[model samples]
Target chain A: MARYGLRTVALVYLLFLLVLPVGLICWTTFQDGIAPVIESLTTPSALHAFKVTAQVAVLTVIANTVFGVGTAVLLVRHEFRGRRVLNMLVDLPLAVSPVVVGLALVLVYGRFAPFGGWLADLGIDVIFSLPGMVLATIFVCLPLVVRAVTPVLEEIGIEQEQAAWTLGSKPWQTFRRVTLPAIRWALAYGMVLTLARALGEYGAVAVVSGRIKDQTQTLTLFVEERFQNFDQQAAYAAAFAMAVIAVLTLLTITLLRPREDER
Target chain B: MATLYLSLIVLIPLAAVVLRSMEDGLSGFWAQVTTPEASSALKLTVVASLLVALINLVMGTLIAWVLVRDDFPGKRIVEMLIDLPFALPTIVAGLVLLALYGPSSPLGVDLAYARSGVVVALLFVTLPFVVRTVQPVLLELDKEVEEAAASLGAGRATIFRRVILPSLLPAMLSGTALAFARSISEFGSTVLISGNIPFQTQVAAVSIFGQIESDNMTGAAAVSTVLLVVALVMLVALDLLQRWGSRRG
Candidate 1:
């Protein structure tokens, strides 16, 4: 077959787009000598940003795990009126820009707005607050979990669930005993993606967080802020850490596939 | 109530934009969305997205083909890398491009291309969409067809053109539509790399953000309204094409 020539194009394409950029990021860490990168990572803000990133990621994952599973079951199991609309609505965030997602929150939470005024009367802060950052991240990353699990549920079949229920298993028990393990890999995969997304989200968080240094800034915004501040080493350091986390998460999702179903 | 929650969040803000857009009358709204600035942004977005998607079509098809057709060293790592952008926050993708082409970066200085830099960055981040979408199609492609084509003395190119490409085209179209929708609203990566220079680097989505910040809701809504229309139309067109292509297949 003349497929041999096509294979060359495919390999080169992979090398240029996927492999090279990752390699470039890795090389960037050591490009200006190890000292700068090392020193940058050691900085308290850089260290702090990494800790916050980890913390936020963990929180986002746990929240998504529950929410994702619930939403998936709601989406797949419940055949209600406007089911199609609900499906599309869940994925609306995917089509909207993260910036708009942030604005949506702002328009809801601005001082003059209904919710914001009440919260402010109580001295509550959202814009430029930790809550704002998490809310925006959650908004942007909402679809990933839903998308990951719904497909698995449909493809896995439901005879097992019916059998469990027929055998007198409670509704929740049927799901726990018969369905959870079936989609656990998908759950894990979605969690990893969500973790990576929360750590790196900036557009939504940027508009909402107000880029307040150290308090609500994410590693991504931290990198951008440092770039504007002309702190290249710190920017690189944050980018490097994010890159590491991304590569690791990507690794996890691909390696641990469920026994059945395509990823 | 299912749609009720969605309408409050998704439909209300969107409808406000549309209502205000037509409130000024159709001609005025047309003028607003088709101004030189808006047209250039629209032109760049559509043309650039098409260019990027076309490029990814070939690249994605090839990557998918290789992964399914052959085994290689670090195959799993290569596969993982292909999906990296999907996991990446658009902002992180933008950050990488900024590092790649900021005025300080060699690529930035050497290229001497001002606005195309934004296109380059957008293309980089959006590259994954088509690739990820097309890979499964390629993976599930029946290898037996190729063998049958080979036995019929069909050349590899002929086999692919007649056998594989035709089967994959529907998926590619659908994937490209998804990629187009994604690239249009891609403010995070483009904002940093483009520097948001008006009439040049400023795209529709960025302009919306600019207007919102300035409290020019009318103007912002106009731009966003155009984007919304384009997104709806593009998605519809893609859906029709995919349906037709699948039926033909």
Candidate 2:
């Protein structure tokens, strides 16, 4: 009886909090049939938003993957003075509000501040441009890959790399041949997480992007703009598409988990 | 190379925020943080986050316990649902909740433009923290101890309170702290639902966003500093808790 009661409570909580809300949005998106949903997604502005989201997500993932693997290897294998502090600082981005993230970037990189002014003089715009949006997304998604790969790197140890080094392999060769194979799944998992976060980022991008439609508006900004302008259909449709991406990411993560665990 | 990226991307910009907040000295920072609207928003955020954390401590633990100890049909689906919040876009999360609980709520339970609406949004975004934290510890737990307690005639409640709860508390608290920090900093999920009414449903993150929109950079930076301090403190606490948890285990 107690077990049944607990199950009921858990199910009810998830039903209302998780399942139902997501289901309702998907249902609402299609209530008017497929034409509006498709049309809403294919509008010129919507398509542009899609392009921007993709470009930013891809760049962010590539950057984070490199940074994540380097940081993980450094944290797990190398000894350094501020290693612990670096570990904690890697997590700083997660603790920050996305809005603060935007504000932080703007303060340092906007055209007014000293560094930003210098960059502006060089005709290199950082804030309120594609570079700003990418930077914001990268900041918000920075820790995912590092966090994911660090544990696996720790478990793998350095014996294999050491053997390769002893056999005359160069630094890059040892990493490419031995270390890379062991951590590939974990690295893949981390990239997936980074991609998911990059694609979903809104608040930080909002502050930094300047939200000029068809220019800086990513899909998330598009959703908010559409909803605020009373374009509920467009908002819901864009939202539904994003939701599908999220769900598919979840499924991919789930599938990858066992394989990640197997090694 | 890694240090270079971390310094440029993560460290410098954050330092800039702290420096910006101190531009007018400590008094100016204090004044910005203590404005009636700013203070009220900060208070609301802290209170709502505390409430959300306390609730998560209980409900999150319960869900983790069920996932580990209980079995039922479609359990895998429930497991997948647990991470949906983390994976979903925050704006979409706000929209979905509004669809269900907003003005035109099919269930007729309109929470939009209300403080409760703000809490619900935080809860949705933070749903994964505690459960994810506690589930692994529960899985690693040995059943032999419970069997030993049962053989000694320990009641179910006694076994739980004495045997299980002790081991679970650290992970539980860590998860709770992470959730609290997250709720304090939450923005996107609360924006549409809370309606951003000052001294009402507005949270600290939304308050910061508003300050930035109004070009009150100093004020925004000051309030942001407060949040950054709180989040840093929580991270330190989390570190200590994890070290303690590992030591005990």
Candidate 3:
């Protein structure tokens, strides 16, 4: 009886909160058949929004992968003063609100600020532009890769690399052969998360992008704009597209995740 | 090199927020944060986040217990579904909630554009945090202890309350803290579902966005400073909790 009660509670909570809502979204997207869904998605501006989202996600993934691996390597392989503080700072983005991140970027890059004023004089628009949007995405997604890979790096330890060094392997060769393969899955998992986050980013991107229609609007901001304009179909279609991407990314993470015993 | 990169990317912008907030000195900062708009938004955010975290604590623990202990069909699928919120965009979550329970929906509960709607969206977004946090702890718990308790004739309730509950408490608290932190900072889903009504449904994150949009940079900075401090405190708390959990383990 107790077992049944526990199972029912779990099933009902998930059904109501997770399954039903996502199911409703998928159903609403196709309720009017495929034509409207395609039409809503194929609009020139919608295409542009998707393009912008892709650019941001790709940029975020590259930047995060490089720095994330670098940071994890530094933290696990070496010790330095204030390493603890540095570790905490890596997680600051996760704890900080996305909107606060956007505001911080604006404070640093908006025209009225000192650095922003200097850049504005050179005709470089950071805020309300692609660079600012990318920066926000980077800030928000920073922790994913580091958090994902750090544990793996710790678990694998430095013995393999040390052995490689003793075998006369150069640092680059040692990293390529010894370190990369071990951390590859974790890194991939991190990048996937970073990609998903960048694609769905709205609050920070919304703040920095200026939502200039085809210029800076991402798929998420596009959904918001369309919904507020009473264009419910277009909004739902765009949202559905994002939802598909999210589901696909989740599937990837699950498949790529190390098995329990493996960990 | 890593430190340099981190300083430029992460530390500088954060410092900029603090420096900007101090541009007007303490008096201005006090005035900005103490305004009715700011105060009400802060209060609402705290209240809603607390409620959401508490609810998730119970529900998430229950889910974690089910996942760890039970062997039902489709268990893997159910487990996968728990992480839907983590991968799904917050704005899409808002739209999902709006579609399912908006004013015109057949469900007949007007959750959209209200405080309750804000809580609902927050509930969805932070759902995975607690479950993910507690699930592992529950999994690692030794069944031998429970079996011993059973052989000694302790009831199921007593064994769980005595043996399992104590071990799970730290994880549950940490997960709740994470949920609260995420809830307080959540803007995307809450922005849409809450209607951004100042002094009513306006959460601090959304209100900060509003302040910035309307060109109140100082006010925005002031409010953000408070949120940043709250986040930092939670971060420290989480770090401590993790250390304690590891020690106990």
Candidate 4:
């Protein structure tokens, strides 16, 4: 009886909290048929929003992957002063609000600010531009890869790379052959997380991107704009698309979990 | 190299916000931060986040305990579903809640466009934090202690409260703190569902967005400074709690 009660509470909690909301989105999105959904997604602005999100997400993933791996390797491999502070610095994004992140960018890069004034004189724009959107996305998603890869790097240890070096392998060869394979899954997981986060980023991008429709708007901004404009069907359609991407990422994480555990 | 990247990417922007907030000196900063609108928004954010964290603590710990200790069907699916929030975009999660509980919907609990809506949106976004944090700790707990307690004539409730709860408290506290921080800064979902009504459903993050939208740069920075300070404090506390938990374990 007690076991049944416990299971029931868990199931009901998930049902109300997770299942119903997602199921409602799926239902509303498809209620009017596939053609309208497709049409909503294919509109030029919608297409452009998706394109912006994709571009930002791809760039973010690439940059974070490099930086995340580098930082993780440094944190795990080297003994340095202020290592603890450096470690906490990596978690700043996770701790700070995304809106604050966007605001911080504007403070430093808006036209009246020091950097912003200098850049304005040079005919360059950061805030309310694609670059600003990219920067915010990168800031918000920065911790994903570092947090993901650091543990794997720590677990894999330096022994294998040392062995490779002793066997006359070049540094690059040692890294590629010994280090890369071990952390590959973690890196992939991090990238997927970064992609999802970047794609769905709303607060920071909303603040920085200026929500200029086809110009700076990403898919999430598009959803917000569409919903606010009373375009319920179109809004839900864009939302469903993002939700599908989110689910796909979840599936990938699930599939990768066992492999991660085994290592 | 890492230090430079951290500075450029993380530290410099944070420093810029602090510097900008203090650019007007302490009095000006206080006036901007303590305006009726700003204070109300901050209060709503803190209160809603506390409520959300409290609920998550109880429910998340329950779910984590069940998943760790019980044998159930579709357990893997349930486990996967728990992380749906982390995977789902905040905007999508908000839209989902709005779709189900918005004013026009039939389920009709008056959550949408109200303060409660903010709590619900926050709950969705932060649902997984506590569970994820607590699950591993629960799994790592030595069941033999509980078994030993049972054999020593302690009842199930007594054993849980005495043997298990003490160790689990730190994890729960840290998880709740993380949830609180996440909720306070939560924007995507709350913006849609909270209706953004000032002094009502408006949260600090949403209010910051509004301030920025109106080009109130200083005002936005001031409010953000408040949030940043609170978030930093919570993060430090969470870090310490986790360390304490691990050390004890």
Candidate 5:
């Protein structure tokens, strides 16, 4: 009896909170059949939003993947002063509010700020541009790949790499041939998570992107712009598309997560 | 090279926020934080986050317990669904919740633009923290202790309270702290649902966004500093809790 009650409560909470609401959005999007959904997503503005989102997510993922792998290896393989501080700093982005993240970036990189002024003098715009948006996305998604890869790095240890070194493998060769294969699944997992976060980023990008339609507006910003403009169908359709991406990403992560215990 | 990247991306930008907050001195920062709108938003955010944290402490643990201990059909799917909130865009999360609970009549329950709406949005986004944190701990928990306690004639409740609860407490607390920190800083999920009505449904993040929009960088930086401090405190607490859990285990 107790077991049944607990199960029911858990299931009901999730059903109300997670399942029903998501299901309703999909239903709302397609209630008028599929043509409108397609047309809404195919609009020139929507297409532009897609392009910007792709560009930002790709850049963010590439930057973070390189940074994440390097940082994770650094954290696990080496001992240096303030290593703990570095570890904590990696997590600082996770704790920060996205708006705060944008504000922080703007404080240093906005036109009026000292550094930003210098850059602006150089004819380079940071805030309200692609570079600013990418920075914001990278700041927010910084920890995903690192957090995902660190444990696997720790678990694998240095013996394998040392073996390769003794076998006369160069540093880069050992890393490429020996370490890469071992951490590939974890790397893939982290990249997938980073991709998902980059795709869904809203608040920080909103602050930095200036939300210029057909210019800086990503899909998330597009959704908000359309929704507030009372273009509910277009908003819902775009939202539906993002929802699909998120679900697909979740599916990928679910499949990609290495089953260490069974192994 | 990594140090340079870290400084440029994370450290320096955050330092600028703290530095900006104090541009008018400590007194000025304090006054900005204590202003009517700013204070109210902070209060609402803290109070609501506390409530959400407490609720997650219970329901999250319960869900973890059910997932680990109970057998049910569609369990794999439920496991996958636990991550939906994490995966879903916060704006999309708000839209979905608004669809079911907004000014619509599918269920005839509208929470739009209300404080409860804010809590619900927070709950949606923070649902995974406790469950994910506790699930692994619960899986690794030794059933032998529970079985021994039961064999010694202790009731199920007593065994759980004495044996299992002690083990799960550290994880549960850390998860709750994470959820609370997240709730306080959450912006996108609450933006659409809460309607941004000051001293009513507006949260701290939204208030900061408003201040930024009005070019009140000082005020925005002030509130953001407070939130950043809270997040830092939570991270430290989480770090200590992990150490303590490991030690005890």
Candidate 6:
């Protein structure tokens, strides 16, 4: 109704940019009989990949939550040498190529590197192991939690924290009672972003992951291996499952973010 | 403690990639990454990234214009959907493109070139950043000037060209730089659609990492150095432009 032209372009852009491509993927996934797709998705490798993805997501969320909360607090409250550099370094992993992150870890943890021999002798197996995949996820996903929490911490300001301190609440108790409640939404926001990212990650995790079937294979890597092996149905099915989770997580984030009314 | 953890996992390994390359003399390292294959991968990466960035330059600005200038239904939804790619896993983006442009797809079957699929893959993954970066600037734009241009009997095209285009130029350039920076490092999506073929569709990020998988650490280091240097230069350039834009603002 509004000059029709702008609306048409908006529709076309959305169709091309978001709807059609995602729709096409969902359609192909359900091809070859829904049963076959479902069966493939339930297979051990796909299941393991999903399970591993969940485990890594959980571990990463836990690790980065602590790291993110502490970083936001330290960053907002403390002044120290190299604080600016530290702030910049914290954001580096966000922009670092996942391929680079993976390869970097592979070099350090693979059999040829110095740490690899020590780890191998200890039977710790970092490369091509579950631990390695989780570690890579943590490295890449670290920035999300920090990004979410830091902005909120800055927004809420330090007046309340100072008030609690003035009220003679112990440092730990003030942090726990006053600061944590104020930042809970930001914390949830950060954790959700980490979980979503850890789920979809491929390159870095794939490199150090070794893609061991039913073991080290994360969902994204599993999809790649399946596609490369020309198990197209399995790949599509797994991709569909991942897409569903991703879309849900995204919607949740959008819903939880400060609304127009809130602002 | 977390910083130490991050340094061990990220910074040290990153340094190691550079160190391995420099262990060979600079000339020797340069010689390795300058091979015909490496040259072609770099070429492909630059061209594809530029193509993606340029396309997004037009489309992103239009979307930003729509979001900023117009009040419409589903505006918030559109804003969030624009951000979908940022959180969308790159691998899934690749898969999405593969599903859209593989041989069986309606357009893929009739495309001018066989490798149009790779372009589509790069396009989807790189589109959102350009859009996101530009959208914020567009929102933050001082609109009185554009409205003034409109009242002066300037036609739509004239207004866009003479008024809006100049102001949006810096953000567009910075966004394009970011788009290129991002597209070059793109491996997850490219690897899926390119079929990992060497010397043709293979990207630098993929090829360099492929060397790592094969334990050709020295050779991989050489290629990694090239990518690292290129990325560092581009990032520094982007930082300067961004600072310049902020200062002027």
Best by DockQ: 2
Q: Against the hidden reference, what TM-scores do the models get?
A: 0.88, 0.99, 0.98, 0.98, 0.99, 0.93
**Which residue runs of candidate 3 sit more than 4 Å off their true CA positions?**
A259-263
Place model 4 in a CAPRI quality band.
high
Report the backbone clash tally of model 1: 1
lDDT of 3: 0.91
Question: Candidate 1: which pairs clash?
Answer: A2-B156
**Residue by residue across B1-249, what tens digits does model 3's lDDT show?**
888877776788889988788878999898999999999999999999999999999999999999988998899998888888988899999999888778766578788778999998999999988899999999999999999999999998999899999899889999999999999999998888888899899999999999999989889999999999999999999999999888888
Stretches of candidate 4 above 4 Å error?
none
Task: For model 6 chain B, give the 10-residue run with minimal summed lDDT.
Answer: B106-115
Q: What value does the TM-score of chain B take for model 6?
A: 0.89
Report clash pairs, candidate 4.
none
Per-residue alpha-carbon lDDT of model 2 for B34-124, expressed as tens digits? Answer: 9999999999999999999999999999999999999999998899999999999999999999999999999999999999999999999
| Candidate numbers, best TM-score first, in rank order | 2, 5, 3, 4, 6, 1
TM value for model 2: 0.99
Question: Please, what are the lDDT tens digits per residue for candidate 5 over residues B1-249?
Answer: 788998998889999999999999999999999999999999999999999999999999999999999988999999999999999999999999999989983999999999999999999999999999999999999999899999999998899899999999999999999999999999999999999999899999999999999999999999999999999999999999999899978
RMSD of 1: 3.3
RMSD of each: 3.3, 0.7, 1.2, 1.2, 0.9, 2.5
DockQ of each: 0.46, 0.90, 0.86, 0.83, 0.88, 0.56
lDDT of 1 by residue, B222-248 (tens): 677667766767756765876777796
**What lDDT is reached at residue A198 by model 6?**
89
lDDT of each: 0.73, 0.95, 0.91, 0.89, 0.94, 0.79
Q: List the candidate numbers ranked by DockQ, top first.
A: 2, 5, 3, 4, 6, 1
The weakest ten consecutive residues by lDDT in model 1 chain A span A254-263
Error of 2 at A165 (Å): 1.0
